[model samples]
Target: MDFRFGDEDETFRAQARAWLADRLADDPAPDPRAWERALGRAGWIGLGWPGTDGRGYGNRCATLAQQVVWAEEYARCAAPARLGHIGENLLAPTLIAYGTEEQRRRFLPPVARGEELWCQGYSEPDAGSDLAGVRTAAVADGTGGYAVTGQKIWTSLARDADWCFVLARTEPGSTRHRGLSFLLVAMDQPGRIEVRPIRQMTGTSEFNEVFLDGARAAEVVGGEGNGWAVAMGLLALERGVSTLAQQIGFAAELEKVVSAAVASGAVGDPVVRAGLVRQWAELTTMRRHALRTLGATGDPGAPSVAKLLWGGWHRRLGELAVQVAGAAGAVGPGPWSPERPYELDEAQRLFLFSRADTIYGGSDEIQRNIIAERVLGLPREPG
Candidate 1:
């Protein structure tokens, strides 16, 4: 497949570069609210949404590609990916697909503009990859809404979030994946919810434990008993397009390491240089596959491949940064410097976290099973 963008795309890229040069230079780090407002004003935030159909830029393949280009450029510049991305990337699309007109009107624009931050209240300590097994219950309160009560662990950014797109059991007697419902709950009210920080190896509290105690809830985006479908749809975005963006970001970091190695003569050692080259090739190849998946608008399962590949690659890149730096690398003051405790600390953290990459999205074993049965037509294992 030809991987080239045509002249129109090229022009768009140049325009994007100029925009970043002007806006990004003034603020190296993104202010979530400001950035969202900027994108919303430019009508660039939700490119995939069906366009206004008002002769304005209608939602189309071209719009999505433009956004992808923007994401890639942002990653290239080492910008921080949104911690509230779960709402923007996964939930918002699901809402557009299944939400009532009123629901869509209420949620989408603010999310697009970053006026509100969101988190996923999907994984309880009890139910993770086995999402169908979620035990968070939502019983009708008789007055109107449901009363939700359960604890959700690893709810990323819940501590600073405004709302949470959550999954809870609505029909206690229904079979797995059959009786669940999705709910959007507020994070500000008391007597219903609690947020506690969960510190990671990175020494940052990017995630939190969310406890729901009699929180008010609405029906799933569409209605009850349809949560399973809504969730599966969200997963498609989570595992597929989300991972594509991540691969782009990781590849950018890989390039920075190569540049540092060359400048320091660390590439002088033939073996070290060869290893770096091999790593770069692998990362680049993975990026191409990711981009192709985005272009084709392929299945959500496509993300499994990207995750499996990059999870390992990110860890390797970090380790190599340490190795290439050598004793001096350990010396303080750079991504490679071991002496800089935080640098070394972060490298170590990423290495440990990478081990969970396959498992988190689904699991390496599970992805292989999907390929074998669904993609490869293998015999299914008996229950």
Candidate 2:
């Protein structure tokens, strides 16, 4: 596959780079939620929309690759990756494809412009990987919308989100994965939603446990009983393309750490140098696989490989970064120390956090099961 960007592509990249540099200087970087909206207003929120009516960004393979490049460049520039869940990846695409005209007009612009921040309400406390088991009920209110009641766990940025794409059971007697519906709910409503922070050991509350009590929602996506399909579509977006972008960007960060380690003379030993070199090679291979899978097809099952590979390599990279950082990495600021300059202590935090990489987005074991059953043509295990 020809990965080289053409002259026009190169020109677009140059323009994007310059535009980002200028806008970033004046923009105040906030938490992930606020940064997304700021990006929306600055015309950087939706890199794939390809029309004047909130779709003019050319949503194609080339556009996807360009997005990868932009993601890498953003990380390289140390910019907080803006364009959070709803606007860029999950909801936007789903809405574009399945939403009605009213739904499209209502959601697309805000999402594209980053005026609205969003989160996913899929996994309940009991329904983690088995998303089809969503117990959140959405009974019709007779006046068009539905009243939702349920709890969702592991909601990323739920506390700060203005909107949420929720999966709820609309028909009580229907089997799991059937009779469910996709609804877009406003989080600002009273008595409908509550967000309890699940603080990580890193002392950051990036994910939250969201409780939905009689939350009012509109059927914003695929028709009733088609929620499972819509959810699957959303999962594909999350796992395949978005995961690759995230992993590639992360690899870039790891490279920066490696560079710092080598420059600081921390890799004087042959073993350490060899380990670093091996990791670099592994990262290179990982990037290739990630990009390929991202561009191959929008298949939800394919992302498990990228997620597993990324989780493994990221954990290793984090471990190596902390190992090379040594005492400097473990400790807080000392005047002008290496750790102090770039907040190297964050490396330790990242190392600790990376431990959960395999657990999130679908565990390594789950990914392996998919590979064996789907890719390897293996027999299913006895239930």
Candidate 3:
């Protein structure tokens, strides 16, 4: 496949780069919430979403390549990591595919305007890799709404999100993937919803453990009992154009590792140089894979392959980062304290966080199973 960008794509890149540069200057806002609204106002929030109904949901519709361009330029600009990405990339696409027209009108505009944020409620303590094993239950309340109850672990941005898209077993006794429903619930349900941040070794709580006790879910997408399909579709979107942007960010991180190697004179070692070279080459391969598979919906294994590649590559990059940093990389910046226990530098943070890169978004084991069973037509491993 020709990975070259067309004229239209390059034009998009220029526009995105200029806008990102302008907004990211002066370190616009300390918190990303304000920046999200800024992106919405600038019409950069939902580039990949389809045009609205005549009532105007208010998002730009771009070609697949153009969406990739916007993401690339956003990363290249090093703009503050988007807080609205969960809504823009994952929920928006899922709603377009499965949500009702009324749901679209009500939800899409706020997301387009970046006024509300969303968190995914798929993974639980036992359902992290095996999502079909989720035990979260959403019982009907006789008002067309449901009361969601269960815990979701590793929910990124749960504390800040105004909403959560939860997958729960709508039918009691439903096991594995059956009888599930995808429900959208408000986050501010007093006494019903609680978000506890999971402090990682990085001394950060980007991921949280969310508890739902009789939380109200007003909207169900793809109808009740059809959540598995909807959730799978959303996961596909997770690994699609968004992965391209992630690769761009990875490129930036890789550059930092390379620069650290040079500064520490670790680039002179043949093994370190070989590792760096390997990372660069693999990144290129991943880029080409992304370009070639942009809209290839026929291949079920594409997303799994993508998850495997980036997850492992990021973890390895973290290892290379610490290695290139020499012995000094292992230490914290200042003396440990109760408030700032993990006062680590950039390399240590990367190393700690990257450990979960392979675990969070479907582990290496799951991806290989998908490839073997779905793509290669191999028999399923005996349970």
Stretches > 4 Å off in candidate 3: 1-3, 52-56
lDDT (Cα) of model 3: 0.89
lDDT digits (tens) for residues 1-383 of candidate 3: 45677898888888888887776676855478888888889888787566444444787767777887888887777778778989998999999999988898899999999899999999999999999999999999999999999999999889889999999999999899899999999999999999998888887779899999999999999999999999999998888777888898899899999998998899999999999999999999999998898888778999999889899999999999999988888778899778776588888888889998888888899999999999899999998
Candidate with better lDDT, 1 vs 2: 2
Q: Over the stretch 118-236, how does candidate 2's per-residue lDDT look in tens digits?
A: 88888888888767778999999987899999999999878768889999999988768789899989999877788999967675778899888888896648887788888877766
- Model 2 regions more than 4 Å off: 26-38, 50-62, 239-248, 263-266, 298-301, 327-344
The global C-alpha lDDT for each of the candidates, from Candidate 1 onward, is: 0.71, 0.74, 0.89
TM-score of 3: 0.96
Question: For this target, which candidate reaches the highest lDDT against the unseen true structure?
Answer: 3
Question: For model 2, how many clashes?
Answer: 8
Better of 1 and 3 by lDDT: 3
Q: Report the C-alpha lDDT of model 1 over 313-383, residue by residue, as the tens digit.
A: 77678778767666765443445445433543443554556655656656667667666776678898665
In the order shown, the candidates' Cα RMSDs to the true structure are 3.9, 4.3, 1.5
Native-to-model Cα distance after best TM-score fit, residue 224 in candidate 3, in Å: 0.8
> Is candidate 1 or 3 superior in TM-score?
3
Candidates ranked by TM-score, best first? Answer: 3, 2, 1
- What's the true lDDT of residue 343 in model 2? 35
